[model samples]
Target: MQLARIHHLLQVAILLAVMVLSIWLIGDVLMVVFAATLIAVILHNLAAMVERRTRLPYWLALSLVVVVLLAAIGGLGWSSGPAIAEQATRLRIALTTQAHSLRGQLNASTMGRTVLDYLPQSLGGNQAGGGDNGMGSRIAGSMTGVLSSAFGAAGTLAVILIAGLYFALSPALYVNGLLRLIPPGHRPAARTLLLVAGRTLWAWTAGQALDMLVVGILSGVGLWFIGVPLALALGVVAGMANFIPYIGAFIGAVPAILLGLSQGTREGLLVMALYAAIQFFEGNVMAPLIQRHAVQMPPGLTILSQTVFGTILGLPGLVLASPLTAALLAMMDRATPPLDEEDRV
Candidate 1:
């Protein structure tokens, strides 16, 4: 009996060492894995819904979901690609001109001048690469870096899609394989908690997607009504940035505000107000309504988790922190018992 207990301890230690070493060795790869898992979970839920509605086989249902997603993406791109490209060009020109003008104004003011002096020379349009002729070289270097990053991103995305499809199609197979690694006595509880986490993630993703859509639509319409240039592009940026939580709206709004200011002070003010109002509604109304049906996280806890994860893993950490926290909360709920019935009443 003592020998068996010692052997079990050895096994546990070995597993722990392997896990820690794997994490230390390929942390970025783990980020891709976690992201793929989340996407797979969301796709699984959609595929399940499709299967129910159509009475299709599981694989067929999953394929149908993928097909629909690809079709929708293609349709949207085909319809709006030209307009977005044109607006993006105009936005770039407007932002560059406005940024230069703002830098000039800041350089002219007493306090602003001091701030600019202390700021990096790069902010003042001084190239770090040095010399007037180096501008062409700097641009070339930047283009190369951009192309490299684009290719890297494309490869990562392809990996994620393929992995997610596999997980979505054979989730139970993987889940069972995972369960086999646990002690027999604990597997039941682990399985139950896994289901809870899945439900929480599905609800969270659905709610967030809805929120993104609403914000994008409202922002686009609001900006268009106010005669803001490139409203569509700004709205799309707003929607995408909304994925990041607290600071996301502000990040999305900055470009719009800058572009609006390029037009006039009134336009800038109007754009700022529009974003503020939309954010207020989202925070006070939409979020609460969604959370009531989904996961209800304390704002402070959520923000704190985002900060810690962002520090550790950068963008992917910031993006996945909330859902991961939600999963942890679900596990805690499963592990902890409720108060006595009398106290509950």
Candidate 2:
């Protein structure tokens, strides 16, 4: 019996190793597919409600929901395109100017001169043919190659959309299939777990959407009032970044400050103050209210999970961390039974 148990342990370990390797190997596609599925799940309840209330066919309701979603995406993209383009142009110009100024300042200082002497050697590899420019070109080429490889999987977007539609349209079937894996006595409990997860996910999504809108509008308005160029674009970036929890606010601030600095020191200071206020409001007031209404995650656990998953999965990990954490909590709640009748009540 001991030998048999040891064999089972070894088998489990090998299986887990394989799973980890598979996840790492296909991390990019998996992230997009998971994101699509979660979005579909959030919209599932709305589609079902519309179908029932309007006495429309399931397919028709599904189509309506898809149309509305596509329209919203298109509208936002169309409206934001020009602002984003302008901001991109301005940001590039600002960064170039800053780099040149910094280089000049460095050249004037003894320490800077010493550092500059080593910079070219540090940047260039030992290859005789590869100078600094060649190294930079190679690095850029490698980045392009990596991006192309990551996105080159044929019809990936289509697959995600179709999978999302199917899941949204017939979530019950999926739930039933999952519940079938449980023991007979636990199937009901499994169903309850699914419901809890769905509710939590929906709540989290709603809160996130509201937070994004509020931040975006505030950032845009603040930038406009401060006379910062590319205010609209910066606002959009801030709003989008706000979805990622802790690190996002800082990332959004960098570009805003850079743009502000381009205007002058005074404008940069104003932008900094405005951004700080926005971060304060978001962290203290907005987050708590949203959490009360939606899924409540422990702040410490949220940060920890974000770090772990982000390390393994990159940007997508940060974006999906909260929802994934909520799902895990739901599972835990289901696994642990109530203490007593009083607790149940």
Candidate 3:
């Protein structure tokens, strides 16, 4: 029996090593798959709602959900793609011009010139904006690479949607298969834990979606009122970046600040103030309201998890850190014993 136990331990170790190796080798692909799984969960919840409302079969409800989602995306793209592209073009020009202007400002004094000398050429010091520098030509040269990257992104998105469809349509199949891996005595407990985790994730996802929507709308309106150029594009960036928590707000704000600087120092300061106000509203009002219905993680834990995951897995890991942390917490709660009233005191 001891020899058998040792053999089992060795087998488990080998399997663990192989799993780690495989994950490292295909981290990007795995991230895409993980993202698809999250999407699938969200879609599944939507399908369940449709099923309840329409009294449709499970499969039919799932299909309807998928179709509607795809239609909405396609329609949005068809209608807004050109406007977004146009705004993005303006954004690039604004950024380039602002960079050149900053370079000139920095070259005005000895200290400024020293700073400029240390700064990278890509940021447009004396090296750029020269007659032979050809900013326009450099941008043109990069268009092919941009197009290729766009194509790659589109292909990855396609895979995500297709995989999401399968997972959303037959979530039970996958869930049941996974449950089968558990020991018979623990299967019931495992099922219960899964249910708890699912509910937590669903709540978190729904709340996050609402938060993103509110932030996007508020940002666009605020920036527009402040007379910021590319308000729509900037708002979208802000909304998307909000997914990463504390660090995200600053990341989203940088572009807006630079664009404001293009106009003047006063405008730049105003833009900075506007973003700070927006973040204040989001943190105090929006997040607390959402947390009432969703899991509320400690700010420190969220930050720590993001830092660790970001170090290990880069941006994709950082983006997923919160949700993954939530899921782990949910399962851990299930595994832990609840304290009695005396213990609590």
Give the candidate number with the greatest TM-score: 1
Predictions ranked by lDDT, top down? 1, 3, 2
Give all candidates' CA lDDT scores: 0.83, 0.78, 0.81
Candidate 1, residues 177-216: lDDT per residue as tens digits? 9999988999999999989988988988888888888899
Alpha-carbon TM-score of each model against the true structure = 0.82, 0.76, 0.80
Better of 2 and 3 by TM-score: 3
> Could you tell me how far off, in angstroms, the CA of residue 319 lies in candidate 1 after the best superposition?
2.1
Off by over 4 Å in 3: 1-26, 103-151, 339-345
| Candidate 3 residue lDDT tens string, 173-292 | 988999999999989999999888788778888888887787788878888888889999988888888887787888888989998877788888988998899889988998999999
Q: What TM-score does model 3 achieve against the real structure?
A: 0.80
- Considering TM-score, where higher is better, how would the candidates rank from best to worst? 1, 3, 2
Ten-residue stretch with the least lDDT total in model 3: 139-148
Candidate 1 wrong stretches, greater than 4 Å: 1-25, 117-151, 338-345
Residue pair clashes in candidate 3: none
